[model samples]
Target: MKVFLTSLFLACFLLIIAPPLMAVVDLYEFDTESQRQRYHALIEVLRCPKCQNQNLAGSDSPVAEDLRRELHQMLLEGKTDREIKTFMVDRYGEFVLYKPRFQKSTVVLWGLPLVLLVLGLGIVAYIVRGRQSTNTRKMSLDELSSSEQDQLKSLLKTSSEETETPP
Candidate 1:
């Protein structure tokens, strides 16, 4: 029983550390090399609307399969890459591409992360520098006027007198 448990644990460990699985099947049903290349390239660039993080070529989701089929049909119709992408963007919003287009709507998508990163780093640096200055503030003797010094001493004397006099 102990040996079986040890073997099962070893198997689980090996499975945990296994390399990423690539179930790459021939997706483009084409006799010519150029058609296949174009088909592959289009699929690779076209993002899966359902699984927005993965391209149609890399994702095995049902929507990815449908998107791939649609891309194949577009290729057969001799649509250029741009036309296909534009059709997709029109059908589903600009989120269909892995790289957002540099148009007005997506400008925030591209710039937001960078802006947040810069702002976050600026705040962190400010805080770290703030923490490093333990004794940065100091009063110079010349900065305090004699009248002000006398006022401070009088205030202190008044506080002590009040304490001793008990109200």
Candidate 2:
């Protein structure tokens, strides 16, 4: 019983700790610190094609692993950042890039927010102006003609009398 308990405890501990120990580690050595930093930043920004929502650095998908290796190899080959980005873009389309380039195809992505904001403001302004005009046009007692005022007074008197004496 003692040996069984010890083994169970060891197994539980391994289950809890082994995952973190086996986490993905970058094994590539960059030519310079700047290259290493750039590699880190690039992985964070580049989305995994297979795991659409996850960045390359955080995704454990096979595609993410392959992309990471390709990026590392490109950096080692003395490829500029722009060249590497273009290569990925050509291969995977704009979806792989977190910050997509501004082009005819992607203009809507960059411009839609501003367009929606202006449209919303315009609608609000129009509604406020309409309300203001309606408020201003409301007929106050002084604005009514003398005959209209007399009619209104008679109507109010009848309404009050009808309310006071229930049907």
Candidate 3:
């Protein structure tokens, strides 16, 4: 029991400490602190092409590593942020950027949610209007033909009489 407890404790300790050590460390050298900060910020925002949902900094895919290296090289070459973004966009399309630029191509991506919301509201309004119209158009007993009203009254009288008299 003591040996088992020791092994469990050791396993727990390793599990707690291992994740921080397993994180990717970008080792590229930057000439200034600002450059390093810029690189870090860019990697955190840039989406990994291969991982789809993960940012370049958090992804372990080969494509993420390549993009990181390219970004580092661009920074070292003194390329402006816009120039680097344009380069990545030219190569990988707007999907590479986490915050995609507002352009003709991306209007659908930005506008789709609003459009869907409007459509949903329209459908709800239509259903509500249909229900209201149906309720308003309901036929009253007074509006029924004299023969139909007499037949309904006779049916109700027979049903009530049958219920009042036990079999």
**Each prediction's TM-score against the native?**
0.51, 0.83, 0.64
Model 1 CA deviation exceeding 4 Å by range: 1-26, 111-167
- Per-residue CA lDDT of model 1 for 61-155, tens digit only, reads 88888878888888888888899899999998888987878988878888999999999999999998887774465565567899988887899
In candidate 2, residue 75 scores what lDDT? 90
User: Which one wins on TM-score?
Assistant: 2
Q: How many steric clashes does model 2 contain?
A: 0
lDDT (tens digit, per residue) of candidate 2 on 1-167 = 99999999999999999999998776888899988988999999899999958999999899999999999999989898899999999999999999999999989999999999999999999999999999999989998999999999999999999999967
lDDT of 3 by residue, 1-167 (tens): 99999999999999999998998776998899999999999998889988959999889899999999999999999999999999999999888999999899889999999999999999999999999999999999999999999999999999999999977
Model 1 poorest 10 in a row by lDDT? 19-28
Error of 1 at 97 (Å): 0.4
Stretches > 4 Å off in candidate 2? 165-167
Cα-based lDDT for every prediction? 0.83, 0.93, 0.94
